[model samples]
Target: MTGSGIHLPMQSIEAQHLAELVEQFLELLRDTEIGEDAALNRLTPVVYPEDADASAEFADATSADLLDRRAADARVVQAGLVALGEGPDAPQQELSLAGSEVDPWLRTLASLRLVIASRLGIEADPSPDPDDPRLGVYEWLGYRLDLLVDAADELDGV
Candidate 1:
């Protein structure tokens, strides 16, 4: 690992999966402009839940900006992911996450997990159906998020 940030050497399969997920996530963010689907709604949560008026006002004022920031963050992570991909079907090589990318990566991973969780109904039920294929994806995202947290902590000398 470099002194600047995380130096994760993910297997090609893992890296490819992550790249695909991120691309899907970026699509979700773009789709938010038309309307808020369940997954997008989960991603940008309401700050003011108690008051309907306040929540609408808040969403009107900040929802676009929040999503914009998220898209920007996703873009940062995407930039790093380009090197990880070998080709359409080829295996990816190692990846080096520079210090500037740590926060964006952390956010992007969380966003992806949230979207997957929303789709899998994981958020509604603490324990979703283990038999479900998407459950594996949800769990995998959590594992990746955990690794990013640990790496960021190490990078920060925490």
Candidate 2:
């Protein structure tokens, strides 16, 4: 059950990858100080693809794609956590979600963890937080858009 065009096995989810992604996202949060939105915007695509693009033909996405991906990723995270037996019945670990771009990122990462745990034959529950205040348009998304447009433009320029 390998993901299409993706190297990892779709059915054999990897918790490590999910964890690493979370770690990287946390780093981005740390790098982007409070009041700055650059970090989250840049990593938006990787964290959530729905907000990457929209209104385009085939395979196109909209800004909401980010939220969609977050939910999907959360499913993966649940799979992983369940696999590890780290769930409601298990001990809760401390996770810091401070800084300008931390809460949303953490939520997305948590979702991914559940997804991974599920793929590994485990049960996990990841509830979406609608009250998160960091849902604003961050510079990070613009940064990624800049790179994507630049790449597309470069190819077109060719």
Candidate 3:
């Protein structure tokens, strides 16, 4: 029996529970205050620049910025999840403000979403996947990064 008290093969893990888990993970990351060096090391290259040196710098910068941004975004997503689970006024849930994966399941989802979005030039759908933490993080990160990237693109255009 799972924490939710309902079990049906693989269907036991409900979306609400998964969302709660994600919230918890985000909260931990926000609170722990992991160093920037560790955060940068964990992230692999996504879109590399033409210049090898420049690409490395880009990756480093992106990772650092993302580490902080993701933590904030995760808090928002977690709040949404909590509201969905226990109603809007359940409690004032807080996050670490640092950033960390709520579950191992979300890592691949984040990578895949970024790849697909970059390739297709499309924003990801906001659907939440409870079974995979990676997908949840990806969904949250997608919207957040989209805004930042769009803003930068606009500034560059100007």
Candidate 4:
């Protein structure tokens, strides 16, 4: 399972959890109004932090296009997740995703992690207090994201 591809052996519960995560992410992508959601704001940050006018102008000009692209990508990832979740009867199964599938999967995972991190107020601190449950979830998402990224990079010969 250590190569340029993903070969994950997951239980039915794991697949269900992944599907739920992707569904939630897709809802956030499709339902949230731009500029109103804190998580979306974090996902799509201002281009020019020092200049309010410039940042606003940039956002106004590009937000629609950017959101459109994200929503489209989310749809693709949703379909993939749904397909992965089909075989619930199997107690144990190995799900394999090729390099072609990895790109969008990586993006979706990263976006989900970003939303979770934003909600959890995760920052540069590597050692967040374990007392907060959200922090633990955020850290786990980061770890998963990193694994996907590494696999994608290996596939791309990076």
Candidate 5:
């Protein structure tokens, strides 16, 4: 699957799980406070690690715009997921998304993964146990995001 040629097996249990993950991601976006949520803080990293003043200034100027874009991406992702889940034959069908849709989906998936990874404190853990449930979810999200990116790259001839 490449370009606008992505085809997801809707009838599979994996597809259903992906839809549920999207829903959960949207819910997290809805509940998060742009600058207040610890999970979201990962989205806006420090611009000047050694200079608190400069970093704060940079963050103050750019955080809102970044969060706004992320929120919009989340909405797009939610709409796409909802559309996929609708209709009587949706489950037993193959859902195809256009090339244009792929970008936002990719961004949203990356954002969701960031949030989950941050919340799970995976970044700070030097060696997380693979058996941990949170690590499992984080790994799953990374795998799905990788698949999307690979598909997009093939489509773009990258």
Candidate 6:
């Protein structure tokens, strides 16, 4: 993090992997309908956990807008990730995120992590059997999310 924003150094493969993940996340958001997938349910919180009817009503009223904003945030992440590289051409790239881009990146990372975690059936367990290869993407998102969060915290102090 600099006086302006967070500058990330990423390899081409890393960039491509991140791009793919975000793309999948966007597809999940746009493609899945409410109650269709448990993973999608992770994106929306139960406002009234005790009252099923109220919770359903709350979700019915707000879930669409909430998911839409999440999609928008994911787009911002995709845009910032454009600075990262892919293929043998660039091999490597740097993305320096500043101003409004920071929050969207943070939110998108969190959302992606949540959806991935939900799909993996990982609740509070910090370590979800590293032996499971499928958990790789979930761990990766958490790692990236942590980096941005720490950087964002530094900027907050400024």
For residues 26-72, could you state the per-residue lDDT of candidate 4 as single tens digits? Answer: 78878888877888887778899999999999999888787677666
User: Between candidates 4 and 5, which one is better according to TM-score?
Assistant: 4
**Candidate 3 local lDDT, 1-158, one digit each (tens):** 01211111111134354465556555544565433323223434446546878767776667556656655655555554444445333233322111222222234225335433433334345444456555554565565345434433443455
Residue-wise lDDT of candidate 5 within 1-158, one digit each (tens)? 33446755455455567677767766655677666777878888887999999999999899878877777877776676667667455347665667777877788778877877787776867466666687777787788788777777777883
lDDT of 1 by residue, 133-154 (tens): 9888888878878988888889
Best-matching candidate per lDDT: 6
**What are the per-residue Cα lDDT tens digits for candidate 6 across 24-135?**
9999999999899888898888988999999999999999999999999999889877745432367666777886788899898889888878877788766677777759
Better of 1 and 5 by lDDT: 1
Local distance difference test, per candidate?
0.80, 0.37, 0.43, 0.72, 0.73, 0.83
Instruction: Record all residue pairs in model 4 with backbone atoms less than 3 Å apart, i.e. clashing.
Output: none
Off by over 4 Å in 4: 1-5, 124-129
Q: TM-score per candidate, in order?
A: 0.88, 0.25, 0.36, 0.80, 0.80, 0.88
List candidate 6 stretches off by more than 4 Å. Answer: 1-3, 86-90, 124-129
Residue 97 accuracy (lDDT) in model 1: 86
Worst 10 residues of 3 by lDDT: 1-10
Write one digit per residue (lDDT tens) for candidate 2, span 25-110.
Answer: 54544465322453343334343346433422222344346545554544444444345444233233322112322324345644
Question: Model 2, residue 60: displacement in angstroms?
Answer: 12
lDDT of 4 at 87: 57
**Candidate structures ordered by lDDT, highest first:** 6, 1, 5, 4, 3, 2
| Candidate 1 residue 52 C-alpha distance from true site, Å | 0.4
TM-score between model 6 and native: 0.88
